[model samples]
Target: MKKLDYQYALKPDWQSDARLEKQTTDNQSNIVNLTLSDNTGFAELNPEQYTWLLSFTYQSTHKKKSGSVCVILENNEQNTVNHRQYFEAGETGTRYLNLSGLLADYQTLSQWQLVYDHCLLMPDATLLGFKKPDIHHGPILIIAPHADDAELAAYGVYSDFSDQVWITTINAGQNVQSLDRQYITGLDDNLKDAVSRKAKIRAWNSMTTPLLAGVKFERLSSLGYFNLTKNTFYNASEKQQNDSVCPELTPAISRALNTMTLPNDESNISSGKRLVDDLASLLDQIKPTSVFVTDPEIDPHPKHIMSAHALALAIQQSGHIPDRVFMYVNHLRKIKKFPYGPEHARTALPPWYESTSKFGHYSCYSHQLTLKTQKEKVVSFDSMHDLRSKPRIQKMLKAWWHKKVLKSGYQFYGYHHYFQTHIKANEVFTFVDGKTFSDSLLQKE
Candidate 1:
């Protein structure tokens, strides 16, 4: 295949003036070294207090390749940290190498030794740092617009901080056709019955999956709103009763589907004072120091974007000031087949597009997972009924056709399902301080 160049529309410069430039080389030795001229202020930094990263922009050449690469960094004492990133044939973007595990302090890192496999590294590279997600600051809250989003994007964070983590899923009543397929054959052939059944299963899945991560069962809840129904709640008056999208389901399963009474059982679901009020109430009650929500700027899904907007409104309404907020993207706007390689591979930054913001301004944090934890994530996703159900015939056929005829692998089915795309060696998040998060959303509105 003759590869064509696919480059970012804007210059991928996080810090254009950063030192450490390298000349392009073809099949360069796996190892390279750079010596920092100035070590000022390096000793002042504390490794345990922050997660450090080395970032560089790169342009992939038009050549037939494995589409994956690894970078190994060696400090002055020969302590090394391994980083991996995948780029498509002829793809261009930036890569961030995680440097958190190196034992030496920054001051002792006067010399740099890196081992690279493929692709071209740009002349400029810079170092960045983000505050660690420490539970001692306060409890952590993770917000998901749909049932599986938390597992898909940040399972590692919640798993690691399970002792103090609270997960709340919004819009768990999505009427996906997979639910219909799974139940229609076994139950009375009514669409409403199938949808209702799905609501219960998904709601149950949302409330239970985190248990595997040692998260308290009492700490899990769902808003139970219908798919694409946030707008209805936002537009209606707080007292006005919005009709249930899935009326077949009981009040408990469809509690937040309408603005009437809500669920108060072990599984809490609500839409009181509209959806925003429900979220604000949770914020006020939990008093979380750190929060996680979908990134509105880069995630293309409508519900994901709306969920972030709702969170911003809730923050404004409650006057709760979280120390920090983590934003993740399950759906990058313009790219398809992202995280770009095999399931076992490491995921760096998502490829940037014309509209995507430049990287350096916001703190980028990569939550690296152990092999054991990755297996745990696989189990967590498997518990979600929607992901495990049989694929539609059309989807199966499309995936087969793509693999056999087009030679392009299927991302949503077969080998490349959630097991592949979502289960990566690292989960990357954009770290924005709570004040900045609130201010940015407000400005956008």
Candidate 2:
């Protein structure tokens, strides 16, 4: 996990002179900056400490030019392990490299690098209309379907404007149907009992969620909670006394997988209406300048779509119109080629949404981060492991806490992928053209 640092890459004096020359030319308009990151950590590895390469994606920007890259690995230690390779890139696209073998060859290597001279692009001139950085104003509000989504999608925005933000978690944060407790083996004897009990614990962990909101402006009251998932509502309504609910095991979203109808449409819609009224009232109270929600129209996840439906209806029903609304993506579209980051935002729309929608198209903007904000983002991401308020939650149910989130939890599918997105300098959002969300669209079809 240990790898070389671009800021302090080890090089011979001649190479240092070359690096200075490269830097001097990079000051020109048409240059592709070559750098390295994702040091995959050094153990006192007897010089093999930081010897590893991750097969991951990285991007470098250029003045709309074509270029090739060359990398060199050298160990300053007594046992020299040196190697070199070449790569080609078009314009400012992403390239994925697997240097595990290269690192393995330099077992006792001290440092490595992307060879400056070979990192060249040719037959390229200039690109017109590069966008300026995205500027977001406060007080911003983020609405997330599950516990870690807000952080995954836009931690840069949250930390940079933490003092001027609020968060609302629309789900109870329990992926209940995914209730296999095998990972807790030896940690708990009564896995079934622990599973049932863990739902409430997830809700409790959720209460302190907004603590991750921002350093300065986000307050406890700035956050709001609503657990509207189909499996469970923090508070349930039993209208028609005889209304039958789905068996507790069924995921609520599964009721209508191909469409967005709530289960037993009449019955659930009644429940949805109650939710609509409550959310409308809350929106009226908050009167936010902007409302943030997940993409419902095309996001394949039903709970997310349902949340969006409910939100649009609430705005329609409440008669409270915010100046703007922002839509963030999760789960549906094929993720852009670049995964980890020097850049955080994506500009593409979901193919399905794009092909079918009358709205046509919209722009993408990135609320790029500062160095301080980037550090705060990494710290905020790492804090997910700290288990704050551990005394009470763990004291009452240590086994569930250990297996579900902390010790053995990375096995959960989305765990690693979610945090990896933060290794960048920006976060992106699709700006839904406001005119598309006109009054008519807010009303029921």
Candidate 3:
């Protein structure tokens, strides 16, 4: 397997308008001041229509073994924009920061400063010309590996074009230990009963959250596979001979899987062969113009990657063609506090650790959201039962100390709070046509 830096794979081609190279001495530690050689592009560049990004090639000098490193851009008025991202020790590569929010007009950008708290500039390059992507229309089908995934990754998308959307979740049969503690039967409920209740709650959450986006309940469906079981659905031959042992037979799962009436046989939800077959079946049914799935390679979650693998297998078998396929990264290779900064900040390009010889199999696009739409996205996340914060008073007190006394932001707290990473001013995706997606993504046996 081969891997590539995100920048070369994602960034649009641009002729460098200007360049800078230097280092800060001990007296000038952590700061570099520079003037642009040309400001003519500023007049034509509107932050509304374009994404203004400053690219930096730098090496970190900080001694921290692991965690995110911070880079900041400060204007003449002392206002600053910062991006903190994960980095390996001594790693060197080009990183990007979004300047859209900080930029108002050409007049205000006469002087700017670069601040690297623990990094030293290797070389500087500015890429000035790129337009924000327009929202693609649908008949869109979103594939969710787990119940909360669609809402976490693209609530902004489905919420924006709700009537044109259909959501199909792969895993609604979850056994949440957290739900076990919430005594539904007043102490009579055992593990099996608790798990059934958990499935029902999440199934309801998946069905209803999209309704707020204007997607009718009928447009949503679940495969009802047990949570985190997508990775096991690949061996079609093995599954055809015998039924899987852990089947979701609960009434709640049946209701979630079938829209009009309940299913009689457990085969649909119980069999791995059935899961793959049903996915292809939906492809033929929806005939979606655009489809969204998690990037199998870039997303770190095993179930998420397996979900993409299943989609690839389904497309190969069904031969149904979609106009576009969008792959989004939610976990981002285990980087917890990515899309970093405050929750409301606009997303920039994700960080890259090194340049790659390979480039351009897929292009990156950002789905910019209007403020009204962003608010609606928040409402969708808040509505999901799984996203609700559980009581963690001890963890909270430690976090309070981390933020208040120690003065380090509670950076680790957002690790599991996906809303913090995903509910931003925009969502990003690596995009390819359906044909390329099907041809390129061959599932591993």
Candidate 4:
């Protein structure tokens, strides 16, 4: 691949001309105050090997300030840089040099320097070599709306990349009562109770069987409560009653209904902050190169909206956003309300459903079957119900099935069935990491 090199001057501006103060200083480090300019120069080295270098300058007030200057980088895509330090500032001077790395591993030399106190300096002093940007290859973390949302939305995609698919549910092993409780108690009391008493062993067995068979199953919580249905009100009185009783829930609910709502708003601000903190911690641990989240605009469900906000906040807080953040469609069954109608609807269909003519039936042997067998094995070992009693076994079976259906992969069956039986759409948002690519380059040649 041919390397591309470009540079622009960071014009002296009002912000860069602001007064500076020395907060602290040491033999090795110095903290100085200086405003940054908006006219920062950006360079794109290559399309495939996307690399960028941003340069700007700030004025210092401290005369003996001779330590390294640190710079932090951030972008809309959630990419960020930890404090990058450069030792280019001269001692006993008001002028401080600002130099930092944006994409450090790329195969091109892109530099920015501080030119006077207000102006930004280019790489006229020293030449840096071009190096290839690091390629990310890791597992994809899919945040499905419900239990089975992953299999319905990206079963084929997961199949295509089975080795790299790590399906996880924001909520898992949920039930109608537990859903009711979240609307009421906002706690995972049922899950804690079940686990404590070991009451829902059959339920857990059935729900987790399919996932363990092929994909890694990670459950955020077994409460399985969704934030969607709780937001909808049948009438004015109901809405008013909810507002009076649970005013705290109104904001998250409102954000779900209103797509234009930003994550920083009052309603989602606290939750957003918590999510950012949590995500920053997760990013430091997982360090995934790419992430998949539901699009809050398209996904009207409150849980989906919250999850999207959380993902965005997490990436921003991490200080190093992944290479890509893909937005997968969550609540496709609600697509009838979309303005584009038929044209937009087609984008939401799964690959299998998109080409029904190619496959005979949607059913395939999976981990779910294994779970059913496990349930029987457990019942036999515990003798929880008499094997000879038909009614008793039938009741246990029903209970087990219900619990199994609550698992992440099984919950999507309801929506998948709706699409298969009714509307046909499978649109999903795929945010590519690195520089944006043209349509022609993305398309198969």
Candidate 5:
């Protein structure tokens, strides 16, 4: 068989891991059996020395229970690290899930073994890539709702093809919640967004940009009712009412114009016009061969939805004709029990329970990545904290890191679970033929 080009293939450790062991279903019981050399239950293991596929068969009893099979490591300090693989209810037979590949760094490679709890429970699990990924030939636009969206959702693809990518941060990332205290204090309404802008810029420069290096980043950030609000676009009915305004720009547009630069100036322009014009111009100039946007249908965040809508409109108006347009899932929000893990390196992406792709001309593909690519993805997060220059940003990341790596407990598990589980797969997109994307994306339920 002709092999695929994967960076991890060249790793000495991966070479040792080339052979895999497969297990058949246990005829004796309805229960799923964990196959391991440690029938004694504790075989000495090294992440580098030991790499094997976790095999499982889905019984009707399982009925589509998809989450993750975690690989947990405990050091002498008793700190824990997690790795997960998600499975859907219907998957069956001997499947290859490599848990040892979870150890992505040298610091994590030393003197460690799987946690008794994760191994003892032995559970079950779950591709996207490109066709002609000479992504550098034309352009690949990464449209992000905020500064960090690209890093969080599409970092692997961005990191691999940095020079070919053009990133556009669509909205001002200033968390309006942070400005609440200032607002009640009678601070000038004008300075609220200014403060938020400064705060976000400080973090972006110190944390986000450096963490995701070698990419061209541009902020076509919008102002006005678009400040930290969801549902920024007017649906068909609302469009008929005001023509230009999205009646529900947010919780309260009357709050104050806190924007720094373009808020007041752009106020005269409706969000729809600004959204169309700004992105249209960007598409015209970049003419990306591949464009990646947030999947409007799945990401429940309002801005995420609106940003997707904006990208659709821009593509429609620009007349640039991109070869491929992709969408991905949100890591933080677990939709209808969707497993949170790394992007899958397979072809043909899966459809969400209610993906809106049917409404447009779109085909999807899931890209499976090498274990090495997944490791680099995790290291990228740490690099931000270690190299960050801003005290405030560094402090924030430090707090988050402490929770993810230090505490084994947090809601829906914790960031530790997310990052560890995340390395296994990724969601990716590709475009379909002959469909006119229109204001349909701007419509409501």
Candidate 6:
């Protein structure tokens, strides 16, 4: 008889460690089964002895109810394991083996054996063949309200899954300006022009760099809006000029002057139509298995809402909708008030359960953004501490911490709050196979 150098080490002492009383030779290979005593398990083994070690813990009451086994195979070198095959007990106390077909490759080897430190349960479980793992392949499209919206919303997802992402912005044109000379008296002509141009470039750069790190960035056409000049409306007369305008009017007009502001009705319709066309074209070209878009309900910005509508419409119009479509919310700022409520709570739509609900329900995939904490390092510490002054700073610090943490997950600006209501760390959307769409109608086989 030929001798092999392999050996077994039992853990917790096997109930019975009997070697095979007899070995049979069949098809140029050796076959042997070593019986084991009850309440015995095997210890960990090094790579030199066995190519792989499979361990399982069967239920005490139902011996085969809850146990798992797997083997690690050497890839390039005999002493190093690379690939693995696993078998686990299923819900009904039945054992299922994963990747059992690969065992055929080992059949040609002269020395192969099964070593169980514990007894085999009655009616030994049969091994099932293995199947290949699914591969994720598709273009992840991200739509944002502003130029930097997608970067702020899904940056982490983009970073983690690089080269598989594409981002599009609805409003991409430069802001308009009016002539107000109050603060420009001391500035030189060349300096002022340089300053203005540099500012615009900076804003554009800020939004593009992070996205370019791992995604394809595209700027969509802008909806026409009013312009501002010298901190005032382009058409505003001298009397209306001031260092500080009313709080409400300041932001609205400021954004408009900086970027074109579209007329409510026209911009909405135009943005919607354009988004639909752009998305449809991209879909037809990529034919992605899965698609991700912004949740229409949680999109407060008019542009975001309009863009989502257009995307939904485009998918409906296209003959082939993706196998799965997932929607993420960007502005989770409002989630502080209703952390446990449905996503619709933060949107303009009614709850999904309501009779008048307009927003559709989709699977919610939520994940926490990771953050690193620094150990205490005193640097010019201050002795004064006041309880009254801490609340405001604490609130601000909390918000800042939240933002920092979210970056670790999806690089989105508001993911933490957005994901609170959508409890799943990651949600999956699956389209009914062989389904088609036409005129927004779904055709199922």
lDDT of 6 by residue, 342-442 (tens): 22111111112222113322222222222210000000001101001233566556656655753312121222333333221112121111122122222
Over the stretch 238-342, how does candidate 4's per-residue lDDT look in tens digits? 222222222333223212222222332342422324333444555555566656666444456677765665555456456656665555554544343221111
TM-score-best of 3 and 6 = 3
Best by lDDT, which number?
1
Candidates in order: C-alpha RMSD to true structure: 5.9, 15.5, 5.4, 25.3, 12.1, 19.1
Return the candidate ranking by TM-score, descending. Answer: 1, 3, 5, 2, 6, 4
- Distance from true position, residue 374, model 4, in Å? 24
Q: Which residue pairs clash within candidate 1?
A: none
Model 2 misplaced regions, further than 4 Å: 1-138, 177-197, 213-270, 333-360, 385-415, 433-435, 438-445
Name the runs in model 5 displaced over 4 angstroms: 1-84, 88-136, 178-199, 202-211, 217-225, 228-270, 331-338, 341-351, 354-357, 360-362, 370-372, 379-427, 433-445
- TM value for model 5: 0.53
TM-score of predicted structure 3 = 0.74
Candidate 6, residue 165: Cα displacement in angstroms equals 1.2
Residue 240, model 4, lDDT? 23
lDDT of 2 by residue, 1-445 (tens): 1121111111111110011113234445322323322122232222212212222122333332222233343442211111222222322322222232233432322244443222333222211111222234535656666555666566766666667666555543333333343224344355444443443444333334446553332232211123344322223533211112122421222122112222233333334455556456556655656566776555657677666666666677666676666676666555432332222221222223122332344333445456565555555554543222223443445445545655522121113344433444445454443335434244334
Q: List the residue pairs that clash in candidate 3.
A: none
Q: Rate the local accuracy (lDDT) of all candidates.
A: 0.64, 0.40, 0.61, 0.33, 0.44, 0.32
What's the number of clashes in each of the models? 0, 8, 0, 21, 28, 20
Over the full model, what C-alpha lDDT does candidate 5 score relative to the true structure? 0.44
lDDT-sorted candidate list, best first: 1, 3, 5, 2, 4, 6
Cα TM-score per model: 0.77, 0.51, 0.74, 0.34, 0.53, 0.37
